[model samples]
Target: MKKRGGIRTAALALALSLSLSGCFFRGADELYAVPQPPKDYEALKVRLSEVIAAGGEYAAPLSGELIQTVQLQDLDGDGQKEAIAFFRFSSDEKPLKIYIFRQVGEEYEVLTVIEGAGTAINCVDYVQMDDEPYKEIVVSWQMSEQVHSLAAYSIGPGEVEELLRTDYNSYKLYDLDQDNQQELVVFRTPTDGPPQAELYDFHGVLGKTDTAPLSGGITAVADGGVQAGYLMDWVPALFAVSTYGGNGTITDIFTCRDGKLENITLDPDMGESRETVQFYTQVTGTDINNDGIMELPQPTPLVDYKITTATPNFWLIHWRQFDAQGEAHPVFTTYHNDRDGWYFILPETLGNNLTLARSDLPGGGERAVTFSYWEGDEAVEPKPFLTIYKLTGTNRVSRASLPGRFVLFPAEGLAGANDANTIYAAEFRDGWDCGLTEDEVRERFAIIKTDWLGNS
Candidate 1:
């Protein structure tokens, strides 16, 4: 459990980014570990300036954290597509180290970076382990504001297992029984109300108090719940697409029998709540031209910053469409997106429910990217951007433009690099390798390459 097997956890994101700003004196005997962006931030800032000249000190290399969940598959069959990072290596106070790998061809090694919850600070995020199939990574940290801390790792090959360490928080991993595996849900705060989802099987010895149900708090992400959506095998019977907050929030899915957490299914009404979700994307429900009955489109409302307000301004974004038996509706949106409003309901047979395809980025406005995430004094960060759109016609959407200057990074303001977990421009294959379906990730992020419409 300690020495070189599974958990080591002690990452030095620029020596906790120069000791979380307070700065310090020589202490880099060796602790480079950097991973993010266009060749992992210039090869970890030139090997962290040679580990700060082998620890002599000059300073200025604290720029990490913007990975938001790793792993891309290819398994290793190798065609290309193996670059995992999962961020938050420093900027202390919480969000301790984590870092998985997959660069191969050019040296980005290091496939693990535990941190096993000592000073706590988790935030990993990932799901899809219904019983035992694949995907299963969760970090979730807080330990206060009503206690929140949980760990559950599971990436293999090079090795990475720890699985389970609850007290729960508002967690989510998805896939509540279409039978693909992937489940783990909680609402562990002070629990003044809704926020109770479960589906345990966390792996190995069973331990960690073990879990079972697949439905309990299908609601409670807070503010009266309303996340509703996501089931593409995020984890076995992993459903938690809320709508209310009364009994456990609006119900929809939730599997895992024998042990508890019921409510097997629901999703026909889908009425209220959207007064303020803000933005979110991810949809793929075939039927293509074959058109029989399938259409689930989402991901279009790029809000890097800037919002039109009549008075009522709301913000929340998240979606994972594909219903009508395809299962997956982890909805959440109240969006305004420069007055776009919102609506997401895919899986009709893809006859074109919406987002046939749309995009923007050839050159329009915002595109710096940094979704933000720190929590604990509650930062939430991430806000710079000018353009990012992808929405065909109907509900088809994708937007961007959040400029006020939208930049922050004193201690690391909008420091969250490139849409970590909240997803941004999904369904791409040539670079991330395999797994594409939201109509092949909106036709590979709606190729524009060189369009018109006020040309880019």
Candidate 2:
């Protein structure tokens, strides 16, 4: 999902030259956001300059973590790191070339050069594919606007071997069979049929071991919704989030066992329904309880909302996880407010007799969201129990010293560029016999931060 536009060769040619010139400096008026290469990287930068000077220029990766022209890693696990650079010659017909250099006595020497076909590099990673103790390189190249090609290379002393090459829509590396070794899982969406997943393992050469049908097609794989987690009995599984171009989302679970890959959500023998989860708002799968296992979000209708209606004002998210045999086990339930970047876990005592409503503050420019008894649509009296304030600017500063209101989320790490004023506070009320108390609210309420979902 970490995609960026291709950098022009002319612009990169100058940037690469100046970035390694050893004289570029940040001015006092500048933001100083760009990072300079470390002193130890000087030798590798010099070697790169020599390669580019020969009527060639390096291109930065269009997508992936390793977007730089040069990347350093210990490919052979020999205690010393090697340098890998992506470049292309103006005179060559190929779109890209890869150069690998090994360290030798305070300098680097060329180990091998590879010819690649693609507009730009997509991703670069290393994994142990065999018992040789040396890691294999996993590189994905952008073949076109919608297609990408993946290849694995085994780098050795003066030898660079290509182990496998294939095209994929989305890819993941996981130990699907709990074998203590990694397997490559590629998801593809054919134009004529539903999407499918192909699992490959290393048997002298990387080959397809099994395949499974996905819940949805290309739209389901929107922006790379695949992830890795464990099922019941500690069995490793992959989760794919799919949307069928409607007001609903689906969670597809895939696992490998006994030499077969199965989509547990669709397998008839598992006795699980393939129904898409309908929700009024957006919902993506995540570890809501921080248990390391991803829970699928199921939208349950609110207490006062009409269950048969097509739309509901609010929803209670029931997070569920699957067992080894593809049976779902409910974990916890919460009220998720994605727009406000937070969620409140409903305690067991609260049950299903509460409802939430939002209103503007008496004064302008602030909001107060209240949770109270589930009154009917026509009821005039709502026994309010908890009121959360969304404050900004002077209101936020003044509420920090208020008496009955407790600040839940401060504006420290959740502020945006234009506005440094944001706060969520809970105002206590007296004589309301709701199952939740002030202490319980503090323990159950949480701020939603997804720093864990990096480049997935």
Candidate 3:
């Protein structure tokens, strides 16, 4: 989920003034003045085609590819929605057109047509600043191979005004702080240097407030999969940044403090591949300890690999707790493995309690497993469960259940189903907790074979 609270109320007022100047109408009566477009997709598409063709500026036919890109969204945040049509005129030299139409009575009327935007449009989304009623349309486009553009426009009654535009490799809208407002994060890569990331305040005239240096330079990976997501819900949201193809690798944790992006130091350091075969930089935001605050699960690494042997790999995992100072320290360590040929389930809080057991299945025939229990209280039922997951290509497939509490065993221990090395059996129990010793847990959930798999 995205963090909230970055836009300041004062800045929002200024942005509204600048964006709506001489264009926006005050009350609700102005909205119904226009006619609504036909509900049919074909009819709407044809109407948009005729409107563009009537422009009379080098009118070339719209391609099937371009015509199919039209979409409907409430760009203005009014109760009623609007249709946005994106199409190319004739040649690559001619700029792309974005036509916004509003529904009036029984017909659609052209609200505004944005011309000469760029050669190609990449993506479009709605962005709201603070508690503002209207949302601005954020458009990202490509002017050329080296020229990428991002612009935010305010759609008023019959006009669309440019709110903010910047030349960056990519852009993201997120509330870097937990204040319920959003900030614009833009990344730029120079042809000769390391990548740069800048944070901008969208409240006023789109001003840059903070900046940081990225790990890999732009174009380091052909389709560099740079990801920016929430890590913790601190006063200012703590976020993680992973470079291209580094989803399961290393991640850099950062936060915005006093208009600057500062890195939150991890004790043993993260993203180092020498200690383990694989590591995770992506931290999930969840309340694992049942404390109101969220905890960060440091990426657990898979250790000890023997490709030729039957011994399964184990997950070396750690949980990090954040102090009031925004620092994180490792609090717990556990070992887990996937034995049932199922996907590994990541450890997370189930219901109101933090789950002690978790698993990871990173594919390549590797599996991760975990066992967890939910004790009965005055309000709930006692439940025990096991989770398994396996990685299929880049996707992690998973299965979990309690069905009267069950356990899975490796194939060598079971008499029947010899072809299948994994055996699943149900164990009905009251519940379990930290008080239960490891040996007691194993005895309670018994197995005939002693050396079926390695210790979890």
Query: What Cα-based lDDT does every candidate model obtain?
Result: 0.36, 0.67, 0.46
- lDDT string for model 3 (321-438, tens) is 5543446665444333334422222333432332333344444443434444434242453344443333233111122122432334432323332444334433323354334432
Task: Provide the clashing-pair count of each candidate structure.
Answer: 79, 0, 21
lDDT of 2 by residue, 150-191 (tens): 888876555567778887777888888766668888887777
Question: How well is each residue in 1-456 modelled by candidate 1, as lDDT tens digits?
Answer: 311322222223343243333112223432333334344335435533443344322222121222223233322222333334333334434335444444433444555555443333434544555443344566655555545667776665456667667675455554444445555556443346433454565344323322433233333343212233433433233333342345323333444444455544432243322221212212222222222332232334333323344432223333344433434454332122322212222222322111111234454332222222112122343222122232222222222112322212111222442332222232221322222244432322222112111112
lDDT-better candidate, 2 vs 3: 2
What's the residue-level lDDT of 225 in candidate 3? 28
Q: What C-alpha lDDT, on a 0 to 100 scale, does residue 162 get in candidate 3?
A: 76
Better of 1 and 3 by lDDT: 3
Candidate 1 achieves a global lDDT of 0.36
lDDT comparison, 1 vs 2, better candidate:
2
Q: How large an RMSD does model 2 have?
A: 7.5
lDDT, candidate 3, equals 0.46
